[model samples]
Target: MPEPATEEGNRILSLWQGSWLAALIVGVLVWGLLIWAIVAYRRKEGDGMPEQTRYNVPLEILYTVAPLLMILALFYFTQRDQTILTKVDDSSSHSVNVVGWRWSWAFNYEEEGVYDVGTPGEPPVLWLPVDEKVTFELTSPDVIHSFWIPAFLMKMDVVPGRNNKFAVTPNTEGVFMGKCAELCGVDHSRMLFDVKVVTRAEFDAHIADLKERGQIGKLDSGRSEVAGVS
Candidate 1:
């Protein structure tokens, strides 16, 4: 697993670790019981037919209730973390419109009114402000594509005629890689992008640079003639 670069990613990592630990504990108990039963209940040469018990109510109930309890515990934690990861509110400092096309991606900085479009040869860079919550709105103009950032430990499906969204606060400042996790078309392997987390001032500077490059309008798939796409 990649090192988590966001708060949400860290929480997900914690959940993953906890789940593995629980599984390991359960595995050990099961194996230990199996081995113990095999060694303790082995047929003795001198023993005739052992006393047959029709049913052990306590053991039957223990087996049934134990598994159900374990399942419920796992479900509770999983649901809790899932809710936190997918929760979206109005507290985001910025919102980015992520448009996934046939073979690349386009990013619209809605708050800054600038966009960055990528081609198959040149993947675009998504500039994010570190320590700030940013909501990503995902859409696909062509076939389905999945917007994924491994470092962030988050991914969302980008479906045509439908909108998907999620929020994350990048806590670390560095460059991370992103890509379309779904196989779309001929150049699906080339549908990639970069995520750069920088300070607020640096993020603003990047946005200004985009504005200076004449990429001032939103390049959403809904609009005609997406600028800066070549």
Candidate 2:
């Protein structure tokens, strides 16, 4: 599979792959030890109740402490990566407000005042500038949904009353697929969208195009107010 297109996504993917490699190494060692014990200790007809041994303090402690250390190491790496990914700075060059509805998505470019609305059949396209930090403020006017972009390897829940935000710098320029990862209602499966990461010039042109089409304005009524937290 293609690696993530964003820097944060790549960092997260690296952590995940590293964790998997560690698990594989541990699994192989443990399985080899188990199999060796099973074969080496197999009962022969003459070997009746071979030496009843109870406590090997060193071996017991080794097994217990080794796993605990491994778990702590993994936890440390995971937490570090999460902090790096979730820490949003005020240096983002662009901002997009995402609203998740019952069946589709709405994206409002806060700076340009351009908005894109998705429908059941026709999905919306989110335009972003490549290699630039973009902040996404996710909200849900109706039910709970999730804004997920697979290429970015990031997904955040769109709750009704909370203003969840995340930032990503798309390093690659291309059109990527996105969708609502959560099942909100009947049309949840069809809640799809496209993400276009282009150059700064192209991004500006896109906003101008939207302005020409009269898609430039604030979001619809009742969307600005945050609903009760659920």
| lDDT winner | 1
**Candidates' C-alpha lDDT:** 0.90, 0.87
Put down candidate 2 lDDT per residue, 89-111, tens digits, no spaces.
89999899998887778889999
Candidate 1 local distance difference test against the native: 0.90
- Which predicted model would earn the best TM-score? 2
lDDT of 1 at 87: 90
Provide the lowest-lDDT 10-residue window in model 2.
Answer: 221-230
Off by over 4 Å in 2: 220-230
The CA lDDT at 150 in model 2 is: 93
Assess candidate 2 and give its TM-score to the true structure: 0.91
